[model samples]
Target: MRTLGNILWFLLGGVFMGLLWWFFGVLAFISIIGIPWGRSCFVLGKFSFFPFGKEAISRDQLTGHEDVGTGALGMIGNIIWFIFAGIWLALGHLMSAVACFVTIIGIPFALQHLKLAMISLAPVGQTVVNKEDLTRKY
Candidate 1:
């Protein structure tokens, strides 16, 4: 079921979103100082490809300890990201969700877009994990 949904998502508009993420990643990479943001963009871009069976979670929650990405620096990073690329990416997802909501079959896709939108808003301290993995100790 997840496979089918992911295939449908990829065929519908997920590919475009993933490409956009990669594009942002490339732009960030070119800036050198934005390497951390570039890396996060690539990771989230991959996540955008097949989001059905996975979720984004805070690193602190997953590891039971605070890390650089889950601390004050992470907050600052998120703020910078939100100002630079997060707003645009989140807006794109919101628009996609709105378009998907036009039909019943698209409702699920719309929900996924909403999830992506939320994640896009503050991606720095988050990591993508399988639903099952989220339950396991890491």
Candidate 2:
């Protein structure tokens, strides 16, 4: 079911969203200070590619300890990201979501886009994993 959804998502518009994330990631990487943001973009890009059956959780939850990307620095980084690329990325997702919502078959994809929009707002401290992993303690 997840595979079918992902294939349909890729065929519809997921590929474009992934590409957009990667493009921004490359742009961020061009600046030394933006490397952290670049890494987040790469992560988000992969998530956007095939979001079904997956979830994004705090890095701290995954590791069972606070990491650099899950601390005060992560907050600051998220704020910076929100100010710069986040708003634009979220807007793009929003538009996509609205379009997908126009069709009954696209409802799931629309929800996925909405989820991505929320993630775009603050992706720095999060990591994507299969949904089944949520039940496992770190």
Candidate 3:
């Protein structure tokens, strides 16, 4: 099931998503100050390429970061991101939506990518985990 979904996703518009992520991730990493944000984009790109079998998890649960979105530093960073990478990522997903809509089989995967793209834009402290990873120790 996942294999089919992944193949369809790639055929429809996942390639665009991967390219966008890789492009921005490189741009972010090229600047030393954007390293952390670049890492987040790279992580998101991986999921964008193959997302059927995974889910996004809270980074706090995985990394034990307390007060991430609420702290002052987090807010400032999120605000800046919202204006910058956040919006671009959202747009990427929107483009995927158009690609998916062009055909019947592409619809479901397109919707999935659209949803995932929303999450990617401002991923912040979010983490992607396999759905069955609940059995694994964090």
Candidate 4:
């Protein structure tokens, strides 16, 4: 089911979103100071590619430790990201979601886009993993 959904998502618009994330990642990678953001973009790009059966969770939830990406610095980073790129990416997802919502069969895909939009707002402290992993953690 997940595979089918992912395939449909890719065929619909997921590939374009993933490419957009990757493009931003490459732009960020061009500067040493933006390496961290670039890495986050790459992670999000992969997540955007096949989001079904996966979930995004806080780094603290995954590692049980407060790291740079999950602390005060992460908050600052997310702020900077939101000011710079997050808004645009999230807006793009929202637009896609709206378009998908036009059809009943696209409702699931639209929800996924909404989820991705939330992640785009503050991706620095988050990690994407198999949904089953989230279940096992608690």
Candidate 5:
């Protein structure tokens, strides 16, 4: 099921999204300031490529920050992201939705993409995890 969804997602437009993130990441790395946002885009691009069986989480765990993922900075960054990549990705989803709607089988997947695209806009400090991972006893 996950594989099928991912394949459809890739077919629809994940490739472009990944590449866009990578491209921006590369450019961001070129400068000292753009590096953070660029890296975030690049990392989040992976999740965008195959979002199934995953969750978007805060980066606090990774950084050991007391309130990394849900803080003032996160809020500000998210707002800025919504203004930038968020709107663009939402458009991408809208476009994809229209294309997918042309066929009956694509409706569900198109809706999924639309949802993910909206999430993509403010993906700051979030990570994706497999849904089944919860079942594994840590």
Candidate 6:
């Protein structure tokens, strides 16, 4: 089921979305100071590619401890990201979501887009993990 959904999503518009993320990530990397944000972009970009069966969760929650990415620095990073690239990515996702929502068969994809939109708002400190991992003892 997840494979089918991911294939459909990739075929529909996920490729574009993921490319946008990677584009931004490259830009951020070139800036040097934006390396952290670039790293987040790459990670989230992969997540954007095939989101089914995977979930983005707070790194702190997964580790049960705060790291650099789960600290105040992460918050600041997110704020900067929001001001620069986050808003645009979220907008893209939102527009895609609206278009998907127009058809019954697209409802699920629309929901996925909505989720991506939210994540795009503040991707810092988040880590993608398989759904099955969430239930495992770490």
- State, as a TM-score between 0 and 1, how close model 1 is to the true structure: 0.93
Give the whole-model CA lDDT for all candidates, comma-separated: 0.91, 0.89, 0.77, 0.91, 0.71, 0.91
| Per-residue C-alpha lDDT of model 3 across residues 1-138, encoded as one tens digit per residue | 999888877766687787788787788889888787788888888888888888877677766665564367656766777787788888878877887788887788777867776786567767788877844764
lDDT of 6 by residue, 1-138 (tens): 999999999999999999999999999999999998898899999999999999988888776765445568778888999999999999999999999999999999999999999999999878899989887745
Against the true structure, what is each candidate's TM-score?
A: 0.93, 0.91, 0.83, 0.93, 0.75, 0.93
TM-score of 6: 0.93
- CA-only RMSD, every prediction: 1.9, 2.1, 2.6, 1.8, 3.3, 2.0
For candidate 1, give the lDDT: 0.91
Q: Give the CA lDDT, 0 to 100, for residue 44 in model 1.
A: 97
Q: How well does candidate 1 score on lDDT at residue 108?
A: 99
Q: Taking the tens digit of each residue's C-alpha lDDT, what string does model 4 give over 1-138?
A: 999999999999999999989988998899778899999999999999999999988888777765535668888989988988899899999999999999999999999999999999989878888988788877
Ranking by TM-score: 4, 6, 1, 2, 3, 5
> Per-residue lDDT tens digits of candidate 1, residues 19-54?
988998999999999999999999999999989899
Instruction: List where candidate 2 sits over 4 angstroms from the true fold.
Output: 65-69
Better of 3 and 6 by lDDT: 6
Select the stronger candidate by TM-score from 4 and 5: 4
- Cα RMSD for predicted model 6: 2.0
Q: Poorest 10 consecutive residues of model 6 by lDDT?
A: 62-71
